[model samples]
Target: MLSYVRWYWPEEDRWNYDELDTDRWSLRHVELRGDGEVLAAASLAEALAARDSGGGGAVVTYERRFGVVPEAPFPPPDGDIEPVLETLSAGEFEQLWRHARNQLERAGSS
Candidate 1:
């Protein structure tokens, strides 16, 4: 139910998060725009957090894009994901990131 919404506008042709190279976790809800505007957005963390609201908020663990660990917990809503994501080994999570980067770079460079 959570998403790290990403978009690229061909005019500038850049990914349009508040910060580039900075991973984002939507606190409440946010709007993402591209082409003209309004691509997609939602209450990412809330949805994730809401799923396991009982105790410390359980994490649906998954390996990082290139991680050494079997599962990295989805970060708590208040915490940063980058630290946890750092556990990923170089080029370990390359499959997804490379594919997306290729697509976006191709799109942006065009």
Candidate 2:
């Protein structure tokens, strides 16, 4: 089955949750092994033009990784926080993408 993985910055929540907000999230298409390990992954933009290689139907996982920033004098330190992951069904993924795309088009025209 095909799966989608999204990595986003939780700090960006200050801005409303815009699904198509490229600044907030990065998306990829992933293939998993039978044991649930990631077999391979590709950027969504690359996968969109290609056909599904077929493993499992699309399962979408959103991961939020939080980081801590130091005060002005110091540069933003880089560290990993335990990621929060959520999985959504293919149908829900399609709906969210469709809505976001429509919103983007409307915004562009305006």
Candidate 3:
């Protein structure tokens, strides 16, 4: 499972939840594996810092699980992977930040 953090700016009154326009939103993906975990922690820390800086935007996090489809003839079936999103309270965000920061420090020492 890969964690993704995104910050949507300008705070729109209404949003089109049907689709994601990555070109306009600030996005970060964290891979929680091996050396990638260290980089992932750093990425999460960056997003947390931006959120804490009074950036006046909405910060959201989600987990994505990639799927593997069987090899098919020509036109393979669509293997759409939907992200699992969670709405976190302020305290939850703080806890996540603490955990990620700890991992980052541990990795740095190693």
Candidate 4:
């Protein structure tokens, strides 16, 4: 199981979630979704710091089981992945998404 921290950005009406293995605090996955599109990070703190650097002022809600975020439609990402910044170009985003998915699948089987 994994632990995660969820953040809500009221200004953009979006949410970003990050997961890390509780024992080692190793970042496993990240998701940033707004209006249904997901942009998915680094370490938990590093990820949040990166976001904060962007000036969004997101508020931390709570930490809980990675896959059990209330009201979120999709299950948490499998370990061994990180999301690209939302500002990435379409082509870059596609490449990053594919890489992340491949990593996730590999992690699951190991």
**lDDT of all the models against the reference?**
0.32, 0.34, 0.33, 0.42
- Model 4 TM-score, all chains together: 0.29
**lDDT of each residue in 9-100, candidate 2, tens digit only:** 35632211112222323343332233433323334443332324422222122111111111121112354553344455666555655554
lDDT of each residue in 39-91, candidate 1, tens digit only: 22223343455446743333322111111111122343554433222232334
What C-alpha RMSD separates each model from the true structure? 15.7, 15.9, 15.3, 15.1
Ranking by TM-score: 2, 3, 4, 1
**What TM-score would candidate 3 get against the native?**
0.33
Better of 1 and 2 by TM-score: 2
Best by TM-score: 2
Index of the highest-lDDT prediction? 4
Tens digit of per-residue lDDT, candidate 4, span 1-110: 55444556555666655443545243534445566444343234543554466534331321221212232222335524333323334445345445544554454467
Against the true structure, candidate 1 has what lDDT? Answer: 0.32
After superposition, candidate 1 runs with Cα above 4 Å error = 1-74, 77-92
Whole-model lDDT, candidate 2? 0.34
Worst 10 residues of 3 by lDDT: 62-71
User: Could you tell me which residue pairs clash in candidate 2?
Assistant: 1-55, 1-56, 1-57, 2-56
Q: Which of the two, 1 or 4, has more TM-score?
A: 4
Q: State in Å the error of residue 57, model 2.
A: 34
- Candidates 2 and 4 compared: the better one by TM-score is 2
